[model samples]
Target chain A: MNGRCVITVGDLGEFGIVARIAGRLPQGRTVLLGPGDDAALVDAPDGRVVVTTDLLLENRHFRLDWSSAYDIGRKAAAQNLADVVAMGAVPTGVVVGLGLPATTAAGWLDDLADGFRDECDLVGASVVGGDTTRCDLVVIGVTALGDLGGRAPVTRSGARPGDVVAVAGRLGHAAAGLALLQAGRAGGAGPGDPAPAELETLVDAHRRPRPPYPCGVQAAELGATAMLDVSDGLLQDLGHIAEAGGVGVALDLSAFTVPEELETAARLLGADPLDWVLTGGEDHALAATFPGGVRLPPAWTEIGRVTEGEGVEAGDRTSEHRGWDHFRT
Target chain B: MNGRCVITVGDLGEFGIVARIAGRLPQGRTVLLGPGDDAALVDAPDGRVVVTTDLLLENRHFRLDWSSAYDIGRKAAAQNLADVVAMGAVPTGVVVGLGLPATTAAGWLDDLADGFRDECDLVGASVVGGDTTRCDLVVIGVTALGDLGGRAPVTRSGARPGDVVAVAGRLGHAAAGLALLQAGRAGGAGPGDPAPAELETLVDAHRRPRPPYPCGVQAAELGATAMLDVSDGLLQDLGHIAEAGGVGVALDLSAFTVPEELETAARLLGADPLDWVLTGGEDHALAATFPGGVRLPPAWTEIGRVTEGEGVEAGDRTSEHRGWDHFRT
Candidate 1:
């Protein structure tokens, strides 16, 4: 191990690191001009562009020991891309701003770039440009751009009182995984210990969330009234739609089917799976409202209905879940 | 002072902080939907969008002690917007991602947001959307988007032999200001001490770079062969133009008129004024190559000529000024 020298970011410098990252990414159809220019030129054929940004800080957002650089990269991209789809737009490209310590191994950055590229590839998008700076810790800021493709954006304020609330993709898996990880770190069977395959899948879900990309467009085509990605939990995000549209959400408790992986992890960790399903975040699921009679595809599951009152109600109980607040939590 | 209660970011929480910031910003004409949505919708009238990203880290990019929250916000927005204009586009909007310590004062963030708005207003843009998260320090990521206006982007790779190299906007002022601040911190006349008005101007330049925004599109309309913003010093950035176009640049030393403020600061600090002009970064001046004999606008000044060889040669001297490398420097 001593014989193999690790090349750090300082060794290659900013330009060299940028070249390496840009070299690994393949351009998508929307990128008229890619990295190396002062700014990238992206085709916005619809005459309107959808933009969103998110920040991920080391330790605050992810632990280096818990997740690999690749995992962090994927999570960062997925979160931002999910936002674009939630706007009913097809993602065109992403421009990243990275802050890393000089002592970081250069290979870690290469793997991170690969992770960004792979995640983008899934949606037929690419990383167009980025800026890198030396900082005391690792910080990643991803800004994703998308085209509306002539469709009116499905905003949070569009849901009507009689509309049906639905979701696409998994819920509670990431929260359950997070619970397990926290438990493991607190003297339970640690990450290094042997675990059941079901538990491992939950851990993987927390590490890298796979958001349903195409479902966003499908919901839009199917005439979604209001939509957003479930980032700050289902109830909390639904509250946004409720507040915006001046309508209330009533979620059916029996409508949810807790995955076996989440159930297994919750049982092992002695946690409430329902609480995670209702209040846990980072699943990147698509939640939208449609007209009461509109047909939703198999990917979408009707979980609730819009009501005249304010706030969110799950079954017969008023939801007290405020979800994740960065500063307060 | 003892009786006054300070509201920290933690007190406001993420939603409160976001609401406070968004409530203060006025949406620009380009914004179809602003801060309340999952993503912002910005008009791209020309069917193409120019996008760029930049990261500014606390202590690494700005010192809270030296610059106010307002100044940091201005600089952040200015730098990213400069990149957009450099692409021969009219800036439309910006999306910011902020990471801040929970203990930070809520007022500081308000001022920062105000700074973003004021700076963007200069070019008819607005802060469309942003994400705020808790972290150990303040980290800012700004992504600026612009409309191409059907103009071909003047990339750095289009320069050719015999093209005239010209520049618009002040150069080396920010560098001089930085030198003055560094000197002040090193026990030379401190910022607290009263200084000459000229020196104060230099310091102000470093804190808030005012790039000549309109000149970018002007250059493009006037048939600029190649162009880029001079953020990495004149010689080093010109070297990029040289390397990209497979040509050489020969800058005329006599053509540069050292500003009085820079000269005064240099004399006080016992540094070479020319060195600052050639090697200082962050002024955000526009440098472009134009066809020979084209009637140049009054805003543009002929500085040099693109030559048949490689690298940059200034006044018979091969410059050794390697500009700032975030990691190495």
Candidate 2:
């Protein structure tokens, strides 16, 4: 008598969920057909298409108790989209493979679809196709496709020594959110509910990421030499750029335009914002290297410079920040 | 020994397993680049591509205790490939998103990769790209892409009255295999333990499905009016074709060549092989409808006829089998 009533998907079925999710998809040139048939046809005019995939499982990637199904959907879609954006391609469409229990609430699936569509719509992409199967827990697998538009793909290996290192979108907030969730769960902060601190925002960031899509394409248009998304920690991902580029990277701490909210939370959490800036993960921020003196877009901020060095740096030292490690803690 | 020295993925990590898996992928046409990059691109000649996705989780789809990782990989690829083929298109490539616990063995991943390549090679297709992430258990999401090569995709909705229904692969073996496994676990006569029994073949069929690949293009070439692959049982998938094509179907069970091995196993397991033939799932057999005496390939068997009726039938009556229901059980 004290809880919300749940509506099982058995009550709604597969096609019913598709109908709900398909309603929010953006009308786009790349999507020839939305999601009614056995398969979908998408336009890949580049003669070549960029593609990446990711999977997020319940409790493993996100906890349903902490985040709504919608948030999980958005996070799933956003991360996969970010991978495409990292290739400096415009995400055209996404195919979602959702595994949910038979008893899962229909409303939850609808909300998750909403999140998927809302995120895809922001990137001018649509949910072109998908499959739904029953499982004991929620598992989402997303495949993202993008159009290069005849532009050369900005690979991670193309950066030169003199390229300028830049970043777009906020970083570290998602990690901060994870930390907040962990802290709240651990009760390391002097017992009781701590007056519902700003940790909720951090948790929200962890649950839903806002990838900077437009900035990624802009980097390509701005003549970036190479690019990649910061799905891992900035320092770790930057290390990839450096290793692939076969050059050293020196980032100036002063250059990172930390989001004001992150800075405030950093203070409240008794942590260094720079740690989040360098070591946090899941922001899905775009990081690219452009030729020196190139005019970059407004969303982008100059983070550092690429040089003859052999490793990544933060004000002359190897940054101690390492982002999410799939194996090691 | 507490337990045989079991190895886990934590020792190798996600990227390490990917490196091993991607290393095993064979290069093929349409794959501009394979794994190791942020994303991959495929050459889409017709300016449009057909896509379908599916999610198969461990235990629910396959038990690790019963299936080797290699078998799981093969089934995963085979199922997805069948979907593209069902659309009467040539499968070009596939991208897999695997969510597995950090403790999974490196050998398991290698076997899985081997399985993927074997099935992809069977169809002259390629494993172009994939994503690997950590999870508490194993979950596989596969997205299959196909090239129409300017041929209009043959869908399930194109069958008209008087269309001839045919099949391009064997059936019921997988279902029989499941029955055998269940019987064995339940301590029944159960398809005689790993012996030279019919259950061996049935088990093999379930572990790795051999879908009809060339039949898709051949059916399209031979002017198949409607087509679908049997993933969710024959009666069920055929029902989908009937519903989509807006026609009734009558399957002549006498025409079905029940493999003697499966029949023998079913008898030993005290199960009805006919039920497996009609209602069991995951054989991935291709079912197509042709108009008026259209010749089928040597691999195909004429099963039944499409009529102006309202539902599907096998022999004298409407199919009592519900076919397959994922959520229902």
Candidate 3:
């Protein structure tokens, strides 16, 4: 309680910190019962709930040295919500499992909670309940729940031979950002430090991916046969759709106009922008297959078509390798 | 996958391992959708869903040497599911977020998924969806969703003076097991290594806690005023009920009969069995308060009575400290 004292998470303890964080969360309509109980209750109007979960480790998912707690929180929520969106559902709530070192600063946790709140606010969701524990490193696990609003879920196994494959939102930006960080081109900026002007977008994309959340539901309503979020590279993710639907995909590489932001980063790194577009992952873009005659949504661009065969081919070049594999390293 | 290859998770890759695991799970009625997609859909027929999450880190929550992958999976699922049960709901599905080292064996993952599936099957639920990533250690985050059957949630803030405090399931068993492990009394035995018969019960209880799942809904139907899963020690957890309801609890020490199993362990360790009952945690038993004159269930034990005040007292002694604080160490 002293003015000069800087209390850590250890000082606040698990219950005290939970109370502090719970006080900061804004209650949304979906949550019938909130935190401070055995469990939280959420409305599931459609008689079904869509669920997904993701785990982010300190160095594996994001480096605390490079990203603020706020960035980590936002990115975690974005990716999880994107999964629900891919299932043609509206995100209703998130329950977080946070493992922090005992010596972690209380301020860092507060910032992290703020990040979750801000991201959830973007899509009208709530942080309902969670668990906290002590560990040697910072580990975050988020489980997102969503309501379907009575729509049939668009799964990966529904594509027909004549369907057109389309994408909504940015591509390869996160990978380019990663490339910049790997090349030390983003400049040595820590949290709250001013990132260099040239690489700001790239770095921010890598640190906090802004997923196009509503596109999944839109695609489903527009008669999407199959859909998935592109957390892995375009070709690799498309391969999942191909394999699941027992169809082949022929991509029109020329259809992809490299975003100007990625182009500048590509020029600086002397790397092929096409490679990032084809193989880069973590952009959280929504990819779906619609009936050939269906009118595409405004944000969607037709990238390819489903064919009779198997696997994916882009511009007569069969991909010899798929996009990012976590175990590749 | 070849017999001579002895492939690990690193060799299987994320998608490959996910495929292997997904194929093993048995589909249930509650799962409108299952894994191998961005998200899974589950039936929430009650119109509202009960949700809870827990994060478990290796070494901190469980040592790989001490627990089998199957045991770890079951324990993690049990703790999360117990939280839902405490809310007077039937667990319908679980989403897991797993962080594993690349070098983890494929066999270990299979066992873990099997563990999750088996536990879900026991409660007639299903494994809906999950995410996996590479990390230095194995970290598991589970979010369980439950249906309340249109019953009002039994929150922790509803107890009143003269209410009867009751518990369903074991106490002090896990702590006694932990004590045996800490004192090096339990011989160094891996999974299936024939634990000494004397300490087998304690050790097994520590590795996997069997919660009284159906008892929670029964308590709620019986008009429980306040309830929680006693993941923290009995006295410590009861203190939560007291604080939340702005009341006091008077525990009758004579009402507690030291289990014969814990008594033997206590004699060997030269420790008080009562201390383990009062302060040991992780048993995950359900503790609840009901109005006076309510008929207690067969599994329920009337342990104390609610008093007008704050904090918890047992006989003439008021608890000086609460049970397991994650930051205490």
Candidate 4:
């Protein structure tokens, strides 16, 4: 950290970071060319398209001390790709915009960019266009574009009563991870690491989210009635689907199971894994509703059912589930 | 300047922002109704597209004291759209990623949204999509999509000897405005209403760029040998066209004229107006070469002609000029 650098972006340099970051991209067979070109071109199928954008700022969304630049990049790309998939579309290309202070090291930017490329690789997408400039802090604005491949998009408003509400990804992990990190930072849990023996994986989950991309596309392919990315947490996100689809949902938490790693971590923080599962965010999981026994994708699991109500119910208690609010003080 | 915090986003938040922004958009006449949905659909002719992005950070690119959120929004959209026009394409739609402190007023965000809408309105393009998240400082990322509409892109690599070099708009005022603001902040500029007499106009140019959108599209339609936006400066940007086109240009600036506001500001600063004309940037004016009478648009005025030379020449003098390099020491 103390290697070199007079502050100011002039000191940190521009093209140098681009060069380092460009080296890490997979240039997946689909990528015609990565960076360095004035523009990047990706394969767009001969049909309609889907495009979405999301912006992430360091310190606001994540801390450098808590997450590597790579994790941040990957998480950013994952969230955007999840949106396209939620629309029943296959992501084809991405354009990233990065803003950083001149005091930032060349390596840090490179690592952050590498994170983006690796995440794009995970989602089977390619980097197309990007622009970088100096800023007071690190900011990433990613735009994900996709091709529909002639399939009609399944929007959030398509769910109907009697539809089975299902989720196809992990829950409670990121929240548990965040709780552990915060606990550790605050000297709440014993010591050593912030998370008790059980929860470090949860902390990892918070830093590096894993969205179920394939499950989303498959759900769409299999005629998902309504689909949404569980970025704001399960109960909260499901509430969105309920409202959008104009239906109510009751989640069977007793039927909901958590990975042992996440459960262990929740226990260390003296918290409920159920609460984490119900309210943790940044997981980028997909939650959808179907009419019947729709052929489930391997990565997805059944969780509950959509009914004729207004809110979400977990077992005995009904949860209002407000969703993640970024601007809350 | 203090106002009411009438809205709590958590109660109505991200979804609220989307609904409000999308509601004010011009979605009927020229734009289709895919705005608030998952993605937007723009009518792209020729089945080809040109795209570009740029990121602007507060403090690095602008000061809150000098610019309103609306101005920043317009500037961001203008810059990206200029790149599309540079490729001889018509802007179809725009997407934005905004990052700012959560505590900031929602109305300011609305003003920023207004700015984006106003700029896009100029080109009959709609604000198709965008994303917002919290950040320590304001960061704006804009991506502009355009349609070639059946014609090939007039690139920087098409100029040739004997091509008449012509410019479609004014050169450099934003840089001068920046200098005025810096001078005012340091108490270097004379005390008056705005420090510099033409400061208002210069500041206006910096805040909301007036790119010659129609002229560029028309120039391409008229078969421009090569085309580009004067983003860096007249001389520096033209140098790109020269180097890429494999032909040199002789800019007869002995017969040069500039906007009166720039002249007034230059005189007040005791600086040469020609310097601004030659190497100042951020005006986003169009520059192109022609093979014949160059079916010029009504707004275009021919300033110079391309010649078989080594570098650009202002009158008889060689322009070995370097424009303002933001990353330079």
lDDT of 3 at A151: 96
Write the residue-wise lDDT of candidate 1 on B1-329 in tens digits: 11248888888889998999999899989999999889999999999999999989988889998898999999999998998998889999999999988888889999999999999999999999999999888999999999989999999999999999999988998898888888773223575544476577778888999999999999999999999999998898999999999999999999999987777777777888989888888989999999998889899999999999999998644667778898788
B233-312: candidate 2 lDDT, tens digit per residue: 88888888888878898889898877787677766657777888888788889999999788777999999999998579
Question: Over the stretch A1-329, how does candidate 1's per-residue lDDT look in tens digits?
Answer: 12349988878789998998999999989999999999999999999999999988988789997788899999999999999999999999999999998888988998899999999999999999999999888999999999989999999999999999999988887888787787773224576554466577777888899999999999999999999999999999999999999999998989999877777667776778888888888989999999999888899999989999999999644656768998778
Across A15-39, the per-residue lDDT of candidate 4 in tens digits comes to 5555555666656654443454334
Please tell me what DockQ candidate 3 reaches: 0.82
Kindly report the docking quality category of candidate 2. medium
Query: What total of clashing residue pairs does each candidate reach?
Result: 0, 4, 0, 11
lDDT of 4 by residue, B1-329 (tens): 23354553233466676777776666534344256545555544444446667787778777888888889878888888888887777787788887766556667777888888898888877788887676767778888877666677777778888888888766777777777776672133346434543357776777778998888778888889888888778887778788877778887775566778777787776777778778878888888888866666667767777777756767634556767454552
> What C-alpha lDDT, on a 0 to 100 scale, does residue B6 get in candidate 4?
53
Instruction: Give each prediction's DockQ, rounded to 2 decimals.
Output: 0.91, 0.68, 0.82, 0.43
Give the alpha-carbon lDDT of every model.
0.90, 0.81, 0.88, 0.73
* The candidate that achieves the highest TM-score relative to the unseen native structure: 1
**Per-residue lDDT of candidate 3, residues B39-153 (tens digit):** 9999999999999999998998999988899999889999989999999999999989888887888999999998888888878888888888888889999999999999999
Task: Give the TM-scores of the predictions, in the order they appear.
Answer: 0.97, 0.93, 0.96, 0.88
Model 4 RMSD in Å is 3.9
Ranking, TM-score, top scorer first: 1, 3, 2, 4
